[model samples]
Target: MQETPFTLRAGHLLPYCMSDSNKTDFTNPSTFILLGIPGLEAAHIWISIPFCTMYAIAVLGNIAILFIVRREPSLHVPMYYFLCMLAVTDLVLCMSILPKMLSIFWFNSREIDFNACLTQMYFVHCVSVIESGIFLAMALDRYVAICDPLRHSIILTNPMVAKVILAVVLRGSMIVLPYPFLARQWPYCRTNIIPQSYCAHIAVVKLACADTRVNSYYGLFVLFGVLGLDAIFIAMTYIQILRVIFSLPTKDARLKTFGTCGSHLFVILAFYIPGLFFSLMYRFAQNVPLHFQVLFPNMYLFIPPMLNPIIYGMRTKQIRDRLLRLFTHKGP
Candidate 1:
């Protein structure tokens, strides 16, 4: 009988080791190799700078939006309420994912622990879901404002709006926490190398030894159930909004309605379309290069958060004016 001479390297830390059916003695590698962008050296050099700039702008922009909304009494309407909620979610998203991603890019070390990896993945998914739900709520707010203008205040009073936001946060949190749990439960039998900047669900699940049928189905259920339903609701809302806009007597009124929703519509499409496209690509487009997988998912994940404040500020006159005033006000 020959015994396997196992040696733990200086860099690799393993809490447990096992020999699988592949007849290969697999020990946890010291550093999970990140197969980064293949072609461009400039791409790698320029990537982190842009990411850091975006992160700073996103955090400050969103926090500024939040403070602007909080300080301005005129902006206390339901629309701004939803905007504030969106800003909060965006801030959370940046905080949750960016630091670790930046660390990976800067340190050249991607050896995250089982627990830490799962934690990052969990928050990323949870916040992603929450942000999506918030978008749905924003769409509904727009629907009410445009379609049922007379009852907008009554329908979306502070208390009711608070409850709706609470429900969205809670529901999103509940729906997505399970994904990380199920992901962490899987035993890694294959390569532990994740090719992306962050720990994504499908990426991690692909390394599992056990069957991932349950996780795959669960993810699809969530995708269709939460995001799909939100898409349907948004479509219906916009359809009715368009209908109502067309029926308006004055061009000014119709334009005003478009102005109200145009920013949100842009943000929504910006976030979801790319996101759904990437998800589909992952499942079907196996031939796509690994670099694109890294790049596109990061865009899908972070760009929305970065762009939301800019979109809203540009579109909403009150917000724009307030931002200018806040910045310009140096009175002691």
Candidate 2:
């Protein structure tokens, strides 16, 4: 008996021998390799510098936001509480990907075990969904504050905020829990080389040897169900907010109301625009260059965490003042 040679075709290893049955046996791959950017392996060092800087800023900035919110008594409002939640999500989001990303870029460490890959995928998708939910919660907070200021405190009390946080975590976990489980059951007999720097759901699903239609559709379902609904509600809330703002008696009143939502709006746009673009590109633009496919998703993951704290600090007066006071205070 003679063994046929395996050929590399489109990143997958296919056996040259095919029987009359037209069937090929595929065993599960023990590990997967993450190919960091397709064409810029030579410049990975250069890429790591900015990525490292972004990671540092994201972690430290979110930590500062957390610290200031905790210490400042005046900052203990629903808005600040939501901001703190966003800060924590951003921190976890960045921490989930950046360390592994930096290792891939700097140390050329790309091989990940099957279970570890699934774990990373689970957290990445879970945290992203949670962040989207948080955005919706913040939008609702702004809506109540602007649309019905008299009842804002009564509606979004400390207990309510706690419940909302708990709900967000539960919803995100439940939706994202199936992704890894489905992927794990599928046998991966392909090249086991994920084209992106991280274990994204779509990226991992594409590597499975079995039919992935269910996985793909479920991903879309979660995408539309969670993020799409959140986006629609956020837009509706802003629409209501706009109506209220315009109905205000004075220009000062309208500006004040609009100003309260600036930070949340900035963060929302910063997060969703790129996120939608990357997702659409992954789904529709199959012919897009590998580097671009890898690049956009990385941007989607990296940009928000790095920018959220800055946007909140600059746009929210209380946060800005608290940050300044924390840095500038002289001890007695």
Score each candidate by Cα lDDT: 0.71, 0.77
Top candidate when judged by TM-score against the true structure: 2
For 1-332, candidate 2 gives per-residue lDDT tens digits of 00000000123322333333223345555677777776778889898888889889989989989988888889999888888988888888788788888898989998888788888888888888888889999999999988888999899989999999999989988988998888888876555777667777777777777798997788777767778888899999999999989998999988887888987888888777667766766676756676766665675576788898889888878778877766788421
Candidate 2 C-alpha RMSD relative to the actual structure: 7.0
What is the total number of backbone clashes in candidate 1? 0
Question: How well does candidate 1 match the true structure in TM-score terms?
Answer: 0.87
TM-score of 2: 0.91
Please identify model 1 stretches exceeding 4 Å from their true place.
1-43, 330-332
Worst 10 residues of 1 by lDDT: 1-10
